[model samples]
Target: SSVSVVICSGDSVFLEGAYQYSAGTYFDTLTGGNNCDSIITTILTFASSDSSLTAASICFGDSMLLQGAYQTTAGSYVDSFSNAGGCDSVVTTNLTVSSQLSVQLSSDTTIVTGGSVVLVASGGASYLWSTGDTGSSVTVSPTSTTTYWVNVSDSLGCLGTGQVTVTVLPAEYLVYVPNVLSLSSVNLEHTRLYVYGRGVESLELIIYDRWGKKVYESSDASATTRSDGQCCAYGIGWDGTYKETGKPLNSAVFVYKLTGLFSNGKEFIESGNITLIK
Candidate 1:
């Protein structure tokens, strides 16, 4: 009698009277019902199994799919399944979880109108700004108060977000008036009372006597030449003289009113006292 059998690796099968553990032809002697010694032949074959090893990594806070389960930590995993040859296919995986990626955005800032500021981001492999710029740093010139956002990405494709706010101050003009005018001074500049400042578009300065009578008045809104040759908006200030008669007035404290329109279309009115020292 002859028989053929197939078994998985590391498995055994009983053939004839003895056990067979490997793939090969075997001969055994068995006693039949007639009490005579009979010879039996067995042909054994093995279905090969497979094994494999792999390595994988993922960012922190993220999960990796290993076999039929998801892994979140670093470790070794094993899985087994039947292969096409009806044998066990074992797979071993070594997973590594990386640390978290952090990102820091620049601090908030203040800037005047039409001014620009530089924003920065750190601890990221790449950066993108709300202004459609891509880099570690970006320059922004916002006309009004605005909030900016940034998105940072790490090498592993992890993403982080941060925000910053910029406060924009409007363009403004300043005015400085003299409280005393030295009419008899040797310096001709000090003899005249002039308004000092910048951004003034139009100005009207009027001086009144103690009896509330209009004395000196002027409409000069031209800017004064600075020491560095830069021109700053200023108007010819009050002089110790009477407007009706081009004559010097006596030394006395007088009331002055100043009104003007700024280059930004803002209006201002100021009242103060000035002393004339002849």
Candidate 2:
């Protein structure tokens, strides 16, 4: 009697026979049997392991998650992965750590008329000003000129500081004259002079002839006001004649003086000599 054996695909089979079987292909016959049988065995399977994953780059205060997603400050992070074979795969991810915040003045330089100054924070999530301002920006109206400082913080509680200097100048009044007096050639007849000044309460214009005789005088003159909410103490129009009589004065050297009274009880005086030419 004879027994036959057959092996299916993808199955491994081993047979003991008198003939030798090499590692490659094999065909063998059972002892004392006329029938022949074949045995086939599948090769060992080797799969490539998954490539190690890591975060490309991360900024300060950032956290990387297991699925490669990033978050801020704090979050769950996976440093390694454990495979079914109990082998742990390395996950080289970096956790950015830094302590930095940015602060800036809203208007680094400003020109205000005794008003409030605004300050702001940049690249920061929270703000803390030395002047007790907690918002992103704060307005500081100091009684006097001062240098202010601000401290800023980020979501990670990092802090930074910035400073600004404010200048408060004293109020000033300026005076301007269209033309300077020329003593050598004085056209007292058709000469019109314009005077400009600020915060003036009164103006006194007096003109004296070469003989030291008062030729013209306008005391407490009616001065025109300027558009800057300030009054201008100015006197215009001078005819080439004497105030005492409508008679032409002799062409000679003359002296003119201007006195201005300001609202603050301050006084300003200016004088010049001019020559009258016929």
Q: How much does each candidate deviate from the true structure in C-alpha RMSD?
A: 16.8, 19.6
Models 1 onward score TM values of: 0.53, 0.31
lDDT digits (tens) for residues 1-278 of candidate 1:
88887889988888746677889988889888999989888889999899999888888888977768888999999989899988999999999887777778777765668989999999889888999899999999999889999998888788788999976656555555778899888877778888876677888988899999999787789888744555563665556778836688999999988888778886667678998898
What is the alpha-carbon lDDT for the whole of candidate 2? 0.56
Tell me the RMSD of model 2 versus the true structure: 19.6
Candidate 1: the clashing residue pairs are 193-237, 194-237
lDDT over C-alpha atoms for residue 91 of model 2: 62
Predicted model with the maximum lDDT: 1
Segments of candidate 2 deviating more than 4 angstroms? 1-93, 98-100, 110-114, 173-278
Q: Which residue pairs come into collision in candidate 2? A: 183-274, 183-275, 188-240, 189-240
**How much does candidate 2 score in TM-score?**
0.31
**Model 1 residue 81 lDDT?**
86
